[model samples]
Target chain A: MQDQLKLQRAALADFGLFAFRCDDVDELLHRATELVSEALDVPLVKVLEHWPDRGEMLIRAGVNWQPGVVGHETFGDDVRSPGGYALRCDEPVVSPDLDVENRFEMPEVLRRHGVRSMVNVVIAGEGPAYGVLEVDAQQPRGFTEDDVAFLRSYANLLAAAIERVRVHEELRRSAREQGILARELGHRVRNLLSLVRALASRTSAQGRTAEEFRTAFIDRLQALSTAESLVFESNRERTDPLVLAEEVLAPHRQEDAGSISIEGSSVDLSARQARMFGLALHELATNAAKYGALSVAGGKVSLGWDLEAQKGARKRLSMTWQESDGPEITPPQLKGFGTRLLEDVVARELNGEAKLAYRAQGLNYTLSFTVDG
Target chain B: MIDNKDGNLSGRRVLVVEDEHLIAMDVQDILEGWGCTVMGPVASAAAALELIEGDLPDAAVLDVNLNGGTSEPVAEALRNGKCPFLVMTAYNASHLFGALAGAPLLNKPVDETKLRQELSALLADTASDRCSGT
Candidate 1:
């Protein structure tokens, strides 16, 4: 008995080392079952993994079981099964003789294998119990306290190994995801810089003084910055178009609170869409404040949007910027940056069209775009 | 062989395929300033392909990634037409796969002078190839 205890102790130490080096949970579990069987001199030893959702303990790994037994067999998670009882009570359950034992019902797999005696101990981790490690013998025999203690120790080692591997895998996955996010952020910054360059170069300096140019460029940049902030703060793939419009027009709304009217149905827009839409709105508001309706008191600028259902789950958003009660309007003699940005740039970007009419009373601007419904 | 003259790009039709509206307009403005007749600043692959089918330009300038889709198909179509083109991207050429992997690559924000120089080289090459008629 003393020699057998020494052999079991030696097996436990060797397994501890093996578990320390092994990274794969499956290989460790299988190795654990084999080591337990060898140390106990039992014909069958199995590791049953607990599935709380299914309320079943699956035979995840085993030694000396029939070909179809391991990975295809399950034991009930209720107290009627020795593995379940041991797991529930967090203690070893020993059935010295199944022929005379009336406490627990024999599992079908054990009955098929002619297993007459068994010992079960819970394999517990730092978080929760992993499952039960069970050793079965064909002959009717008793399992001593020493055997139970050794088996418990072996189970503990296996649980620690499983947890370590799980944590390692999780860390690796997060690191990979972080790398992707960093690369994506870099790409976005580059695109933004390119966009700023485009804006600067395209903002014609033909007529405006240096001060005027600076103000116009800064205002446009501020509009873009506002759009970006809104897109990020929403923390979603799409942002509310109405909220975006209100936010972009917030600065100009202070002087003539009732003059600028913005009404729109709830709609979601992508980051790019919101940016382009916001820039166009900024241009319209700037133009209105300078030469159109918002330039004088009692002038009015009403912006309204309507959604029209289109074919194949698509929706068309039609927005009208109607200005009134200001100085009489006349078409510009030459096409400027503002006109090109509204009619050409914004339209092409949104895959839509923008029409501006310099009417006698006011400037009427209409924008129409298609979006996924 | 190859002419790097100022008026060489004049009357040449160049198609521009880019998803970003501002960038697209900027490219159009630059190419138009060079006296090249810009066919498009199309945003998507389908639109670019449609334009290609309707009429092939003298050459093309394509962005590698168009919105969510790659410009590989458009590059393939341009290749079949034997039209010379250059690629502009926010990424490295190694990141590009298939046909875009080997095409002339320019990173954004593209240098206006370099863009002109590269287009001149491509146009010069094509012009020389036509004269040789081999």
Candidate 2:
């Protein structure tokens, strides 16, 4: 009697340390299986959950069981197995002689897996049974009442640990979803503010005259807004220069009637360059429509670009906007806001150079810049 | 602002679908001044659908984008109803609504004279067709 008391005290102390040391669900289950098998001196210890929907017992964790049969084995719909009966009734079930108990029938599945005698303790959390913790032996080894009671206490602690881990995983998933939503909202707000800025700039440039300027300003702002929408839809960190050029030129493309040609290799530009380039293209297209190529019948505008490698391992992009076949060309006496915007403002903001050359036939503008790597 | 040169649509009903309140009101005024009975200035696709179901208009002026790029359903319904509608958009008309390939397009903020001219032409065509049927 004294030896049995000592054994019970030792088993209880081991189970207390094992439960406290577990950090997560998998760790807790692993340690519980090890502790139970070692304390009861049984060859196999398993924690099986009764899936009521499936009417099956699933071995969630196991120790010292058959090499491959631990998690893969399942006992279906049979209340005969010790685990199923213990989980259903929320009781500790012990079979001293499996051949004797009429209601306690041994499942052939468990018997084939070398489980002879077993004690199943129902693992309960707050209200009902969560699963079953079982200790099994290859031979007909009888379990004392003290062993069953100790296992029942440990089973409750394991169930609580499992619930804590599940809550932690849910919190992590919620945090990730919230982060994604916040990022998308910020991106949309930034794009809207940029649109407003472009509108203000275009309106300010069209002179102080109310009706005439408003008409021209709205036309230009609409063009910029279209380009901005395309950039946002692409979801690119840096806009592709070739794509920006195509979007700005789309409204002016006419098949075999009037030509607006583009020639260059594809290059990716930063957002600043993309926006400034879009503004410059809008200015060029407007000029073409009013006094240059596109204004006359059968007139054409050619836009071309090339990337030159610099000595310091940098690439300089050179672009030219040219117009042909229009009315007699003459330089304006005073520089308009369009000229100042294209020549000084856009060039300075983008860290580039712009030159406007008034040729005999049409207007020619060149822009050059070294982009960052 | 409504140029009723042919004077065909002096009593026909017209619907205006625009998200911007000022723009919608301007369009309504233009259509009403043309002697056409105007239905709405509805802001969203849902509201437009509700208005149409309540009283189907003879024609509509639709903004290609509202809330986002989701005005295609409204366009489809109008087409199914066999209503000759015009699209008013700030976007590049070809790029945004290319699928409605041969439909009439008017860019916004609309020019007053151009808006009057186009609306008159479209309404006159619709009125003549109805007269021929009768």
Candidate 3:
């Protein structure tokens, strides 16, 4: 008996240390079962959790079970089961003999396993209840009151460990989510910088002056910023292409006048597509403000799009920007940054075809892409 | 027939694996201006890997993160196949662990001139011995 008490103290001390060593709830629960078994010298000790909603007890954690992992279930919780009896009250239920014990039903889960005697203690009872702790024996045995008291203390420690793990799991989940969010923010910033660098490079290649490149690049960046903000505000992957065009042209439009006329219906574009398309609009609007229809009084620009019929029953969304009522258009000797962005980058990125015409009357830019919707 | 500043990158195929569209376009222009043939500015690492499986390029410029996925598999393939490649990333070197730690890394907002200079030297050295067989 002296040895038994000493072993119990050793087991209790080990369990306290074990709680701090686990990274997973499964490992923590398994260690609890292992410690319980070692303390009492039982081969089969388990944590049977009450599932009132499920109308049965579940084997949450177990040791030396012949089948299954932590998810396995237990038999009905009728009065025949000592776990059920312990769950009904706050105290421990001690069954010394199953041969003549008629107080409760011996489930097949226990009887088939050759279990003769068992002690079931309520794990926690401050509120609803955590579950029942079952320590079983294969041979007939009478459990002393001291044994019951010691088992209760063990159950209390197990309950506290479960709560600790629950809080730990919550903290881990929050940290993981924060990590993902930070990564996403980092990705967005990187993409923004790359885009800016590319824009500056291409703009400088064709820009006649430093001022021209700076002005054009910043406008394009603003358009990109607008598209990103709209997407972020909606908290969705798809943004309205019409809204994208309007937002890009908003700053360029003549104050309180009919300088820009829009004619397109709403259509969905992926965030990537929206940003590319939005940049194209910024280029067109900026060019119009510089030398196209928006440069003169009563000058006007028509920005419109429609679903057009394609070969083999496919549909294409065609967007057009026509400028009129400005000075007679003179084709530039070299294609500028706006032309390259519209004709090359936008076309390539959206899988569309772009055409820029320096017509006698004004400039007309058109793009046709397969409707994503 | 190669110089440090102006190597004959003409007609040499170089694969560009980048997810950002405009950056890829800039790379294409710079590579094309140097007279090199561009293989791809592929949007994802998986697609880039698929493209190189059938026919390897003379050299490769791989972005470390392809649409939020690591381009390590492509890097591993290039290494295993005795191919030379450059790694570009927005992430820091400390965050890069394991088999991927020690390779060359160029940060985002890449300096195009430096990239060209490095590539020219890399190609000039290997182009003499490497392209002769392929």
Cα lDDT tens digits for candidate 1, B1-134: 44545537887889999989799888998999989989778888899999878477878899988878988898888777778889998887788787777888888897898899889888877775532112
Model 2 score (lDDT): 0.70
Model 3 reaches an interface RMSD of: 1.7
Please list the residue runs of candidate 1 whose C-alpha ends up more than 4 Å from where it truly belongs after superposition.
Answer: A1-6, A311-313, B5-13, B50-59, B113-127, B131-134
Docking quality tier of model 2: incorrect
Clashing pairs in 3: A80-A104, A80-A105
lDDT of candidate 2 over A140-169, digit per residue (tens): 867777777777777777777776666677
lDDT of predicted model 3? 0.79
- Most lDDT-accurate candidate: 1
Alpha-carbon runs more than 4 Å astray in model 3: A1-3, A24-27, A41-44, A63-73, A77-81, A95-104, A114-117, A125-128, A137-142, A169-181, A205-212, A307-316, A360-362, B5-21, B28-105, B127-134
Model 2 TM-score relative to the real fold: 0.45
Q: Where does the lowest 10-residue lDDT sum fall in candidate 2 chain B?
A: B125-134
True contacts kept of each: 0.84, 0.00, 0.66
Going through the candidates in order, their DockQ values are 0.73, 0.01, 0.53
lDDT of 3 by residue, A1-373 (tens): 8887888888888988887666676787788889888878888888988887866788888898778734686756656567777887668888898788777788877877889999999888446677888988999889888778889888898788777877888998999999989987896787678887887777763525778667767777899888887777776667888788778888866483478888887766777778888898888887877888887788888889998666765568898999888888787778766787888778877778998999977899999887566
In candidate 2 the C-alpha lDDT for residue A58 amounts to 81
